[model samples]
Target chain A: MKNPFKFKKEIVNADLFNNDLPLPHSEEYPDEEVIFSVKDFQFYYDNGEKHALKDINLEIFKKKVTAFIGPSGCGKSTLLRCFNRMNDLIDGNKKEGEILYKGTPIDTLNTIQLRSKVGMVFQQPNPFPMSIYNNITYGPKCQGLRNKKSLDKIVYDSLNDVGLYEEVKDQISHSGTSLSGGQQQRLCIARCIAMSPDIILMDEPTSALDPIATLKIEELIRKLKEKYTIIIVTHNMQQAARISDYTAFFML
Target chain B: MEKKNKKINLSYLIERNIKNRKYKDGITNGSTFLFSLLCVVILFLVIGYVLFTGANYLTPGFITSNYSQSSVALRTPKDFVYNENDYDFSDLERFDDTYYSEKWGIGLQYGKDNNQNQVIYLVQMSENSPFHELVRRDDGTNFNIPSDMYLSYITVQTELGTYKTAFSEDGIENMISTLDEAVSIYDSNFLTLGGGISTSLITTCYLILFTLIFSLPLGIGGAIYLGYYAKDNRITRIIRSLVDMSSGIPSIIFGLVGATIFIPFVGSMTGTTGGNIFTGALTMTLILLPTIVKTVEESIKTIPKSMISASLALGASNTETIFKIVLPNSIDGILNAAILGIGRTIGESAALVFALGTFITAAPSFTSGNTTLAVHIWYILAGEYPAYEQACAISIIIFCVVVVLSLSTKLINYLFRRKRER
Candidate 1:
């Protein structure tokens, strides 16, 4: 008799629709092709007892790698999560100001559509408890991609893109969490990529990995920037300098 | 509020303190060991007493035979043949104390009857035996010897002479030899009495299956709602506290509920006027839901919050995330719940007595009221002539199932951990 969904204010519909269209005024923005524009964006937590981010202004260009580097508790990851509205899940967390995705406010777009295009990877590699193939296909399958051939292609291509194919190609049906910490992060990125998103956000993805794996992910990021716009938050200054084309410093 | 100054003790002299410390340690250590030893001893005492008493009565006939007795005064088979080496009793496990006639293919053992009075048991009857071919004397209807039977009286009429003996006045060897030499056996066995628990064992199995069938889904659903989706509020808190409290209530209260609610409800479909196994199963479901939910909730809670976020971040809906991520992760706990439910269902009694009557017979259907192992124990012990040994025998059977269930739980969890590790 006690229902949990009854307490929820938002009913999320993540179904695919045929009405999605391309961004408006794309040509009017000129040659730079600014992917996301944050103007006076401020964030607070715990009913404003904590001000996480304030008056932040930044522009992320298309097919470019931008990094947010700062000391701890500076809301770098907070701002990154705000891009996909991941912070919307928490209770009593308030946000003021606006973020524009390709000259259109992100709030106007459907949450499913917005998140489909703006994918994210967490600080710790948290793969869903499932086989590698199922883990990679979960998002696409949810949106009704049922063609077995295409699903297999998506799985192979995404794993290959992150350079994890060579290591885990034989055990695609194995559990995703069984992989090493480094391989798990790469699998998380591959899972995000399997959705074919336009942007990929990584929050300290390599923090838990060894240096060799970090180098591989940095190399993957450099190669990935040619096709997808990336926004990463990291405390490693050299990592920001090595991988990111544009860097912004964040503070509490 | 006023604060009192507390004195903290420090060892003024380390060497002097060592003696005091050793003295206190000895007392504490001895008491801890003593209490733990007491716990182990109590466990073994209960198990050993039950096993020692019950093991004596736990025969194949006691486990696999019927609960009631059926008697036939006269029976004759339409096609009767007595051939040499017609059947062999050599392969059968011999009760050394039994009188086995290899020529007639019958083994008769001295076992206690239903009332614990010493009687001759018809332990074995191989194919083509005269007993299997015999017919009722009064009505001339064929009466097949049940695999499990007791020898009340046997009469043999041979070409040489007529030999007869009652169970009480048996030179069993002479009677059986006379049986082997018979040209025709006459009204051989009369009044096969009941002592076995085949009905109760089967009833326990059915109740366990039906109880799990009804309770697992509800328990898992409640656990998922509380673990993944529920808001921490007064209503949920109340529901949680109720679940905890329900597990503590006596099983008899649940039996009363089943009697009041489920008996009539099931009776409508089953056409049973009294308490039935289905009603008992419903009661068992009510009793087991709390354990199932609690274990599942504990496992579901152990799943990292990041996995849920990761799924949602990948554009999967909350529903999709739960089915794929949360449910799969908590499978070990669900299995554990099922095994625990089975163990509880086997050992349950008081509630089942109210929901299912302690009438052990041929389980005509789930609609027919019958006793489970635990309820059978209660029925036997509750009588004026308490059959403690029989009750203990039933206890041994219940304990076996529970032990096997618990061991399988451990095996399943181990396999799960190994799979996850791989």
Candidate 2:
């Protein structure tokens, strides 16, 4: 499918592409703790019939926000999915070289354990066809958290963290899909947070949303950096400059 | 001036072309619509005719009563004779005996014989008597009384008077001495004459119940395996094609299979010699599996891949995801398959006749031979005297049941869709 945000790359002078936005510079985080390091990473599709990403090396610092920015078909989202082994679901996909999480090779860790600690939000807000309350508690419940009071607290805190608690408190029992696109994205973020993961991956999470919802998500990411490591893929350069402390550019 | 003229010509040409296309489209569309409407009309007419004809015979007694009635016949003695002076003739009203030449009537009268002992005389009354007329009018014919039979009384009635004339005491004694025994016979009621379908109905219910019980789990399990776990390889592809092909195979073939395989298997288990409801249900299960599996697989496919991914991402196992997410979403399809299966079971006759037997028993046992509603209709129609009225009534009942099943299926689907939307 052709990327819907392809025009954003051509519009260099657009507000979202501004270089003068007030943002935390990466220089201040030079000595921060490194959580993940990629060494000579390579990714392939269809059993190496097609090369998707090549010669990638990068580091994600602890409790810091990192962003990958590029045009469509540049493998930004593909590389982000590699962190949580989401690429394992696709048939005929292969990866070479090493990825380390806290100085341990990621291959040694169980995929389920890796995923629970490294949650992901997709480009579209693909919430399960269930109530908002269940959506938030799904991850926690899967982790064997069954106490009702604890679940309630987790739901309130997660929704509160994404600033959606007040807007949806009256109708929390409503389907998560019934919310607007912005609220749905926030719900997805809240759902990711409820797992209490150490790292959260966002794959163009705001591409399907309006500018207002995008700004809200960027602000949430800025606040979330204090508690969790965040990595986001975006085609909008200014979003990366505004919310991320470190930015890596990919070229097809 | 020339440009303006050309513009007007162009506009006129476009308008003519548009009108011409619309006229052609209308003809094709109208013809197809009329043909479809005609088809629907014909279907309704057939159903209406069945209901109209069968409504006359669909009485409550027809459903509840047994097949035959018990009756007996008694014969009188030949030695008894009538005496004119034995009974009073004062109240007698006489009629011409022109209507009495061949008809004879029997009447019972209590009197004393020659020995002065009380006896009941079986009298052969004359054709001109009131008892003969009463019997003829009620029974639609005259009694065939034998010659030389004795009489104890002759009852005659007229507008002027009523009289009871008796025979001699000696004739009554001889009649009582020579009379023979009474013999019993059973006459079939309306149901035995091909009016009732209670047995067939019960058999159909049994077949549907057991078929579903056997097929649902197997069908759904196979569907889950195919939809979620099976690899998209040559073997799986061949299996899928085989399932599809089996569905298209004539059900009569399945009937043969059931007779050859299921009947013997079930017969051994239940210890019966011939086909029964259990064997028929097993045959139906084989016929229904393809439909159930295909529909459920399709519905499972419709569940978004993202849901599975989301569940897996939440650290849930593959089995957990399948049971909790995939099966729940495919419930509508499962129910739809069951409805279709029921419709097939009810309308099935050729297969069941071979597998379940064609005998309609009043109380069908699981291990005993029986006929379903469809087979019952077939039996009635194929008999020496075709009972179309009762056959049509059974058809009406089957039609109603199928219609109700489909309507309920639609209602459930609609409610599920509405809930999902909410």
Candidate 3:
């Protein structure tokens, strides 16, 4: 909800809900449609005892790869999670900022709807303990897609897009975790793609893979760039330079 | 591998290492082995003794038969002969401890009555007498007469004279030989016979079933609240502590609570006066809730946190995630809770003594009070003539049941893990 009223005296944890507070543009970017704009954002952990991120400002261009490369504990992953409100699941989490998704305040959007449009892949390859086909269809089924044909198409297209269909075509019904580490990583990406999200968030997605797996996922990301806007946070400078179109550096 | 091993001089290093710590290693190793062996020996010894003593008595009838019997006075057949010389006790049932006389056509099967009094038990009458009617179970070859009847007196006729002998006299056996020659054949006293664990076993089974019926939902519900939803706060911590503490409380306390609260509550609905199987079950539900909640919560905790995140990220609601993932995954824990309930309920006697009375009924009904297998042990052993053999036999049954439940729990868990892994 966009709140109009604001208290002169700030109440702890309640100040961020004063949604009508305006933010001035501080940085210049190309005239492309800004898919996501972070304005003076601050993130805190341990009930505001530790300031994980402070005064962060950035603008993401449509259908382009934007990488956040920073030292450990600089809250790169925290900011990525904030885009889909994944941080809300954490206990004692507090944030003060304005984040807009396609010019609309992200807080105003339904979380499930917003997350359906903004998919995420974690650092480690964490596929569900289920068949590969079921893993891809899980998101669509959650969105109430009951038709078998549509789900099968989604599964086939998603796996095809991630370059995993050929390798796992014969064993698509095998347990997702039973695949090799890199194959599992690609499978996770395929799972995210099945939801038909507009933007894909990768938080050090290849950190747990070998060199060969890293190269494969990087190539997949470049091909996927034509369809989905990609925002990745990685500590590997070489990975950012090789795969990302624009990069932002952060320091503790 | 051979070249690497040749360079290391493995034998020399091994000899040096062993010599330095040989004394310390030997003492510790010997003590550990001896202690473990001693523990295992003690365990097997106890079990073996129980099995050995109980094996001789563990018959199918002993388990399935009823424990209580009623005695009755029966009359001789209209064509019964008074010939003592034609006495035949070949078909008479035999027991090792009791004495039977073929000439008298009578037997003292189990010497002691319910009152623990040593008395002469009447077994058989004439070949066609109405006093000793037999009805076979499964087969028509054997018969069990209702027993425990007392004989006030008996009139016997011999060559010397006809004399009246009271049952308590020392010369009662001398008079029993002439019992068939008595003036009135219909003046004999009859006895009731019964002793088995079937009723108590049935009661325990009913107790486990009904208690689970009432407890699983509540226990699992509490577990969900504690495992999935509750935050780490003062209130939640207190609630968790209370649940843990409740499991440690003696079941006897729960029995008292049942007697005061649930007994009246159940009695109001049932229209009975005091505690019965239903009330006992209600009390057991209370005793088992904490155990079930803890086991269920622990199982729920075993689920990886990532699965929950994955489910939520897929746009599944919290309730959906819980029902689809957490509950299904935690089934092993739920079954374990039921097994724990059974083992505890079967072995529970102190609490049942209050919730369910010490009375052993032949045909156990939910409306009236009856003892379970455990309470049955307490009943017989608490008496003057303690039936240790029967108690051990009952223990063997309970032990086997517990072992079977434990093995089944393991098998079920293995199957679940296998299915999940596959």
RMSD for all candidates, in order, please. 5.4, 13.9, 8.9
TM-score of each: 0.85, 0.74, 0.77
For model 3, residues A172-243, the per-residue Cα lDDT tens digits are: 899998999999999999999898887899989999999999999999999999998999999899999999
Give the poorly placed runs of model 1, Cα more than 4 Å off.
A1-30, A103-105, B1-11, B75-135, B142-147, B154-165, B173-189
Q: Regarding lDDT, does 1 or 3 come out ahead?
A: 1
Q: lDDT of model 3 at residue A140?
A: 89
Note the chain A TM-score of all models in turn.
Answer: 0.88, 0.87, 0.89
Q: Which candidate is the best by DockQ?
A: 1
The candidates' DockQ values read 0.62, 0.40, 0.35
Per-residue lDDT for B29 in model 2?
A: 99
lDDT against the true structure, per candidate, is 0.83, 0.75, 0.80
As a whole number from 0 to 100, the lDDT of residue B66 in candidate 3 is 74
Measured by lDDT, the strongest candidate is 1
Q: Candidate 1 chain B — worst ten consecutive residues by lDDT sum?
A: B162-171
lDDT by residue for model 3 over B1-422, one digit each (tens)? 45554477789888989977898899999999999999999999999999988776676656776787544343344445466444455666676655545555565433444334445655445463433543222233434454435443354444454555446334345545555446334334444435778889888888899999999999999999999988777778999999999999998999899899988898889798777999999899999999999999999999888777767776677887788778987999999999999998998998999998888988888898899999999998999999888888899999999999999989988998887776
Ten consecutive residues with minimal summed lDDT in candidate 1 chain A? A10-19
List model 1 lDDT by residue over A1-252, tens digit each.
224456433333333222243433334445556778898998999878889898998888778899999889999998999999899887667889999876667766667777888999999998877889998999999888999999999999999999999999899998898899989999999999999898999999999999999999999999999889999999999999999988999865
